[model samples]
Target: MDEIVRSNCTDRMRSYLESGCSLHYQNISNLRHLHSCERELEDYINEANAVLKKLQRLVEDAYDATLTANLSAVKVPDYSTADSKMNHEYHFTEEKQEQPADELDRDSSLVTVMILVHNMLKLDYTMQEKIVRSLSLKSSSAEIESYRLMWDLRPYVDGSVMDLAWKSCP
Candidate 1:
C-alpha cells in the first residue's frame, strides 16, 4: 500500500511540474495539473479505504475476544434469596392473571387510536410506541403512562427538565 501510494504521489508531482513548465497553452497545463490532483486523490482514497477495512476487521476481532473473555469470567447469579423468589412470584402472578378478552381488545384499540393520533400530530409514532412498550414491559401501565406524560411535557416545561426526564427514562 505504501509503495503504491508513494508511486502515485511521485507520478502526480512529476505531472504537476511538467504542466507548470509548459508554455504553449496555460489552460491545458492547468487542466493537466487538475487531472493529476484527481488521480492522486483517487489513489489516496483507495488506500484509505483499504486501511479502514483492515482496521474495522481488527476492531471486530478485538470486540469479540473481549466479549468472550468477559462472559467466561462472569459468575452466574444465586437465586436462593427471598427477594429473588418474591420477584419471581410477582412476575408469575402478573402473567397468570389474564385480562378479559373485551378489555384486551379495548386496550389494543386504544393503543391503535393513540398511535394514529400521534402520527397525525407529526410525532414519531414508532419511537413513541417503542418507548411505551419497553417501559410497559418493565413496569405497570400507570407507571409507564406517568413517565410518558412527563416526557411529553418536558420540552415545554424547561430544557433542564427535559434533560432530567430523558436521563430518568430507560
Candidate 2:
C-alpha cells in the first residue's frame, strides 16, 4: 500500500510539475488520486457497513420486542415513583379512589422488564460506541489524507476540491 501510494504521489507530482498551472492537470490529478485510493475507501466503507449492520440488528430486536409487548394483553405499568411532597396523592379521599394491587404489580413488572432489557443491552450499546469511535478515526484519517492530496495539488486548480466533492455527493 505504501509503495503504491508513493508511486502514485510521485507520478502525479511529476505530471502537475510538467503541466505548469493548468486546470486540466489539476482535474486529472484529482481523478487519479481518487482512483488510487478507491480500494482503501471501499475497505473503510465495508468496515463501517459491518458495524452499521450490527446496529441495525439491535434496532430490529428492539422494534420486535416493542411489537411483542404491544400485542400482549398484559399491560405494562408506568413506573414513576411518587415524590415526598406527592405522597399524599396516593391517599384515598372521599372524592378519590385506589387502584387494585394486581394493576400496581403489572406496572412494577413493566419497569422491571425495561430495566432488565436496558441492563442486558448494555454490552451492545458499548460495542456500538466502540465501533462508531473507531469508524470516526478511520474516516478522519482518510479525509485528512484526501485533503492533504488536494491541497498539494491546489496551485494547479482555479477552484477548490470541495466544489468537486460537493457535486459528487448530491
**Top candidate, metric lDDT:** 1
Worst 10 residues of 2 by lDDT: 93-102
lDDT of 1 by residue, 1-170 (tens): 65765677776566765677455577778878866765664565566456555645654564565545445434444657645676767776456535443444444444443333333322333334344445422477787677678557633234443454345334
Local distance difference test scores for all models: 0.51, 0.51
lDDT of 2 by residue, 10-92 (tens): 76676765777366967889878866666565566567557656755665575566556545534533555435435565555
Q: Give the TM-score of candidate 1.
A: 0.32
Q: Highest TM-score: give the candidate number.
A: 1
Listed in order, each prediction's TM-score against the native is 0.32, 0.27
Which residue pairs overlap in candidate 1's backbone? none
Q: Tell me the spans in candidate 1 whose CA falls farther than 4 Å from its real position.
A: 1-24, 75-170
